[model samples]
Structure formats: C-alpha cells, structure tokens
Target: MATNLALDPSLIERAVEVSGEPSKKAAVTLALKEFIARREQRRIAELLGQLEWDESFDHKAERSRK
Candidate 1:
C-alpha cells in the first residue's frame, strides 16, 4: 500500500541510524512495526492486575502429575 504523511526528518534519520535498515523506506517500515508492537504490549500491561486468580489451581503440580 502506498500512502503519504508528513514525518519528522530528524526522527527518520535517527531511526535509520538505530535500525540500520540501509534505506529510508526500510527504516520507516521497521520503526512503524516496532511502534505498533510496543503499543500493543503497553495495552496488555494495563490489564496485568485486573484478572482474578484461582488459589486452588496448581499448574506446575498438574504438569508434574503427568
């Protein structure tokens, strides 16, 4: 897909240096991918303390039983 948006020159240069992607396109692509992955991880982290755990469940013990 081809799309155009205004991007910061310095950020592009820094991404090129850090990612060592050899081209602006590659660097931009890698940066966007990493950015999305990091955002998803942060979203998942926000759910860390909201889940209920079962005190009676023993996953390791179940594995050992096998």
Candidate 2:
C-alpha cells in the first residue's frame, strides 16, 4: 500500500534519533508497533487478578529446564 503523508520534519528527525531506526519509514514502523503493543499491554493489564493459574507450576524452572 502506498500513502502520501505530510509529516513534520522535526518529528521525523526526533523519531529516527530516539528509535535508532535507519530510515523514516523504519522509525514510523517502530513507532506504530510500539503504540500497538502498548495498547495491547493496557488491555492485558485489565485482565490482571482475573485469571486463574496453576499453583504447582514453576514457570522459571520450566524455562531453565528448556
């Protein structure tokens, strides 16, 4: 998909610097990905203390065994 956008030059410069992305496109992609992840995290936060877990399972031990 091709879209034409008139983005601010300074914003692009700052995004590139902060994100460490090689190009404007990459910086924008990273920004969007992070934004989506943050939104998803918020949704997950809403589920906190509402989910059931196995009391006997040690997640850290399983990962170490793997």
Candidate 3:
C-alpha cells in the first residue's frame, strides 16, 4: 500500500490539525473512513419512505409471543 499521489499540502495539513492525528497517514485514513461512512449514511437517507409498512402489524403482540 505504498502509493504516492499529488495531494494538496494545505488540505493535508488542515486535515491533520483538525483530526488531531499524529501523522498525515493517520489523518488520511480517518478522512477516508469518515468519507465512506458519510456516503453510506447518504445512501440510507435516500431510501427513507421507500419501504412499505403494514398498518395491521402489532409490535406488542409480537414481543409477547413465547
């Protein structure tokens, strides 16, 4: 995983400072994880109200079942 790329130095510095990571690699890792989580959350958000709900379903009855 020893790859190099032309990344912005200022952005990297800001990420390190804001994330309080000890090194650029740590900051980048945290940024990538957060980016992935945010994208997944957005995808889930987009699914809101897209599922069908049964009005006759009784949650209390289901919970009381042995």
Candidate 4:
C-alpha cells in the first residue's frame, strides 16, 4: 500500500545508519518487524505461569506409544 506520513528525518537517518539498510523503506520495514517481534515476545512473557498444567499427564507414555 502507498502511504505517506510526516516522520522525523533525523530519526529515519539514524535508523538507516544503525541498521545498515540501503534505503529509508528498508530501514523502516526492519524497524517495524523488530518492533512487532518485540511486542509479541513481551505479550508471551506476560502469559508465563498463567496456564494450568496437567499433573496426571504422562509424556513418556505418550512418546512410547508413538
């Protein structure tokens, strides 16, 4: 999709320099992907210890059957 936004030129330049991306679009795409992955990791981290475990479930038995 073709979209336009007023972004900080200095920040974009810094991103390109630090990321070593050849173009502004590449830098922005990499930044967006990293941002999304970081956010998803944080979300998954928040779920830690929130799930119930089945104490009676035998993993060895299941593995042996197969």
Q: Which ten residues in a row have the lowest lDDT in candidate 1?
A: 57-66
Residues 7-66, candidate 4, lDDT per residue (tens digit)? 999999999999999999999999999999999999999999998999999999999895
- Which portions of model 2 miss their true places by more than 4 Å? 52-66
- Residues 1-66, candidate 2: write the lDDT tens digits: 898999999999999999999999999999999999999999999999999999999989988894
Best of the candidates, TM-score = 3
Model 3, C-alpha of 17: deviation from truth (Å): 0.4
Q: For model 3, what is the alpha-carbon lDDT of residue 15?
A: 100
* TM-score per candidate, chains pooled: 0.82, 0.69, 0.85, 0.81
The whole-model lDDT of each prediction reads 0.94, 0.96, 0.98, 0.98
By lDDT, is 2 or 3 better? 3
Q: Any residue pairs clashing in model 3, and if so which?
A: none
Better of 1 and 2 by lDDT: 2
**Candidate 4: deviation at residue 14, Å?**
0.6
Worst 10 residues of 2 by lDDT: 57-66
Q: Poorest 10 consecutive residues of model 4 by lDDT?
A: 57-66
lDDT of 1 by residue, 27-58 (tens): 99998899999999999999999999999999
